[model samples]
Target chain A: MDLTFTDAEDGFRAEARSWLEANVPAKPLPSGDTAEGFARHLDWERSLFEARWSVVSWPERYGGRDASLWEWLVFEEEYSRVGAPQRVTQNGIFLLAPTVFEFGTPEQQDRILPRMAAAEDLWCQGWSEPDAGSDLAGIKSRAVRDEAAGGWRVTGQKTWTTRGAFCTHLFGLFRTDPDAERHRGMSYLLIPLKAEGVTVRGVGRLDGDEGFAEVFFEDVFVPDADVLGGVNEGWGVAMATTSSERGLTLRSPGRFTAACDRLVDLCHRQGAVASDPRLRDDVAQAWMDAEAYRLFTLRDITDMVEGRSLGARSSLNKVWWSELDVRLHEAALELLGPLAELDGDAPAAIDGGAWMKGYQFSLSGPIYAGTNEIQRNVIAERLLGLPRK
Target chain B: MRFAFTDDQLLFRDTVRDLLDKECQPEHVRFAWVDGDGRLPQLWQSLGEMGVLGVQAPDAHGGLGLSELDLVLLLEETGRAGLPDPIVETAAVAVPLLAEVAPPELQAAWLPGLVGGGSLVTTQLGGPLVACADTADLVLAVRAEQVVAVPRAALRLERQPSVDGSRRLFRVDWQDDDAVVLAAGSVAADSRDRAHDRGAVATAAQLLGLGARMLDMTVDYVQERRQFGVPIGSFQAVKHHLADAMLQLEFARPVVYAAAWALATGDPDASRAASHAKAAASDAARFVGRQALQCHGAIGYTVEYDLHLYLKRAWALSATWGDAAFHRRRVAEFVLGPPDLPDRPSRSEEIHHG
Candidate 1:
């Protein structure tokens, strides 16, 4: 029933808060999807790496501080509270690293993690393709065994590869056994985008950033060492990735709480607290929703510490926080009124149109990492024992 | 950092849950709807014997001195069973406030009887309406920053027909001379405020259980009932609705637990936490109730079916302390400062929108 953090955790929070307060960029960096911004974010990422705060929850062998989960959460809260730059290295550090830790070979972990921690190697996910967006098992990517070469020859096109133009490598599912079941036959592979036959075409996102891309591979040679989990076992391994993606790894409650605080500030600045009761209430509701998510994560982390499995409950978390993110941003935009539509460059745009940009970004939350519709199906079938159609 | 109940707390909850499962089934609830008092005395006595009624009362008052955190889960069990009693009004709100702010003479007169289940107690903390006032031996009412304890004999009770037949609602009329003032001034105001929070959080926990029960009933029903030559549960639309319902309940559950913890620890944010809990739980339960009925279709609309019992109870309790909108306003005040306008719309107008 205890809710207070341990003194050590409080100390960890204080330390992280001080470090972030001092080091975070005074002005926000440009979106990392642009080349110049990508380079700028890399410096920030390296600064975090230098402080050993980049992967606080990872093992010290991989350049992390080997912090506990509670400490990691504390660090995240502090990081968000200080309004630090978005983690440009998140695709690798948060999403792929957890999978790599769980399913990567010792040699692979030794080779991959430190570089990821240092942001020397940028990784993007290649899960969704032109035909395999929500129905990910409908992946058409193939990898033929090149036994003579001691590897596989991969040929595929992966679309909606986030930050693909900027990333050096990609991790995706490729069919290795065509004859197996729909969920079977796939292999999780880590492919270098710099490889000879690989091509990347940046796709414009709603925010007008080249954050999305279509990656094409023409018989790119990948060594057997690059396969994660195992051949024909990619479905299971990728499930682990999706769970972490939907769960605490990619989106922690800290991000939303920070946004909520900003939303409250926006309301106060606009005098909406006195002018519009309904909008003020919306701001408060958003704040409370954020707090609820924070409390939810505490219970969730408690369960993890107690050795309980999250199972399909991660879907619940996904549906909640994603929608909350959208609502928080929407409230900010409501306060901005018609000026919400202005670009960051516009003089009249409030907060450099950060709320507008954020609202656009939040639109993707329900669509990516498995659509909310699909997550709902998973929740009903797996979590609530509903029958499959 | 351990945001979970201890083994002892869970054990106590499990005991009450098992007792409710055995003795307070839907049939017992149905019986209460037709019964004059809308109560099951035997079940109430069983809860008293299990120390469920006296969970927050002092040890000297024939009770188990436990915190709200220990009793909250049990309260959820009561809601799940739709136990058709004013346990939230009595055990959770009235008894605790009485134990805290009642004078020695007042405490001696009522605490033992209330704790021992020899007397029934109901309170009016939110509005003019009082629940189960007809059956309660004592009615604790908040009046102008004073907490007055009145014997049922001294009050005139006008029954107000409610959606949930298992609950007896009334508008009570009483004279100041007939009631004893338990506490006055700032102490009374503080205790009254705490009681409101307690009532809200307790109702939030109950709504969680009631929503859970409705969802379960709908899930079970959908699996058995068929449509278009297939089980209705197999329909993606039906499943999605149920999934959304489950999502609401799941997120709201943690909020309720945290609110209970905040109250138990007397956290400075207890008022806001309680309001947050009530708002979240009320919204979740109301949403789940709608979806549950939608998923069940015609069968759910009937009184013979079990879903309506929980659904009705959830609807009643959602508005019990202060409906979702009221609590949300409180949270709004906690986050954004109090509204500056004096000519704001009345509570009824706001409730209409809510």
Candidate 2:
């Protein structure tokens, strides 16, 4: 197997690296989880949009360079390396855009993707209700026909709506048939978050920011123009979103590799901690894990290119990166010693408690998308041919 | 770039796997372990005839000239079948080592025998004991960065039995200077270092195979062995355990193959790559082994059953070239810079000797 990049890929990397070096903001943006910070993050995304750097993997019509998967990976590495601000539009561009591209009509793509590229239409995922988390098919949210209101009216509660507090729209699964049981008659609908009957209450993450929210919908009207795929085929359509969540789109190896490097830098700054053998081994393990994740991501890309359905392997990727994320941050925090516990502004806080912030965020990884426990069940039953319960 | 194996390599792996399935059954393994010196002479001859023995030996030595990447699948399949042989040593390691660094006369005396399937060669490259030193015609020993070709008859042997009974290891008492010096100085050091890297990668690949085998066995066991009222695999805890094992094996696998490829391509980071592979594979092996045994409940611990075979082999090979801790220290040195902790000297020596 060839791990080396071709000359063309190398050239693309060089171009991406140079552009990112020049274009990244001179100062760090505010935390994207905060209200004001979210706006600041949007401005940066707008800059990227003008320069066609917001979504390089998308086609030219969606304000992208039409880059290949490998080039997108390279771009991610280059973008994150400069300590660039996080992508506030990732929910729309990375997670939901693929479903739109694959399942939505040409008109829907033209209407939604361009605004998403320009960061004018940030999106939040509407999975994981208070009751229906890992068992996504148990969703109780309903979207009944409202002929008088001119379309479907959605009534439900969507918890853990990542970026829901400040987002303009949401793409969620709504049960459309009263007679159909679980996993049937489900419709995938894209609704405006500011519709008349919608309410979004911010839910605080470990970092004490309203990074996600509990979105309440009471007769929120959604036109028929925005329903994705077929009425009862939402399970199949949403399965693609699950793949996007677990695979390259959500947790790219570039982000972790960059974290590993940052972790090593922190260790070296610790002097004595860097020299401790146990901590050194932990550092080595972190690097090894990140490198392994990188190679595994490459294998995933190759498999997709070869026309093999991702199938159960996406669950494998989810388990891997989520654990690695937790481990790498844990190692970094452990190396930081007593300073690790301090908040960002405390005098004793090390690196502004970035590691602590990251540690908290990392803890959510295995729980969100799908719990690692559930992912393991998928691996056992589907991949290992274990009998279904 | 393609990260998966080529069609040809997949076909080769299948052929090796099919052969082992037919010839290396548990009874044959038990028979070799209980009744003989544990060397499958006939299988060894067959491998040599297939050029598996000389895959890396130079063209002049009547070899296949294949690199570590080609031999890794063969070694993996061997590990899966729990094959009791040192073809990995004789073919994958010794022939290549001798061809690269053996003294001219030593090469003349052994290389032809090696490629022609008439002779078996065991190896001891900085490991504590020699594997199959008693059964092989020659033992390639390394000391002070020098490669020596020692005749099995030249030394007194004390049998050092491994936890895995099929392995026949020995503590050989011989004069280092009395043996044939294949090469000395920096050239010898380079050649021996190369061999050690290849050996470590080969061992890591084998451990991965062992892990995969145990995972398969445990998944099957959990399905067939009922508990409460249904197959235990249907239980959440059991499924989670097997899934975790499968994840470890999957993660370790790409690392193992990438290390093999790095060694084949002579990447400057080949040493670090092999260490990464070894360390990861070691964890995967132990994790899979533990979970497999636990999942088997009562039937797993008994030697009378098949689970013990792969479990014991997993334990045996994880410590062969370099164990998890050993390779982790090496990797630490590579990635974290030189260790400057209080135990720096001891850690340095541990890395240096291995």
TM-score of each: 0.98, 0.98
Candidate 2 residue spans exceeding 4 A from truth: A147-150, B103-105, B341-348, B351-354
What local distance difference test score does each model get? 0.90, 0.86
Best by lDDT: 1
Cα shift from native, residue A374, model 1 (Å): 0.8
List model 2 lDDT by residue over A320-346, tens digit each: 899899999999989988788899879
Worst 10 residues of 1 chain A by lDDT: A271-280
State model 1's lDDT.
0.90
User: Judged by DockQ, which candidate is best?
Assistant: 2
Task: Provide interface RMSD per model, one decimal.
Answer: 1.2, 1.1
lDDT of 1 by residue, A113-148 (tens): 999999999999999888999999999999999999
Candidate DockQ values, in order, are: 0.78, 0.79
| lDDT, candidate 1, B77-191, per-residue tens | 9999998889999999988998997877778888888888888999977566888898888899876567898899999989998999988899888988998888899888788
lDDT of 2 at A128: 82
In candidate 1 the C-alpha lDDT for residue A354 amounts to: 92
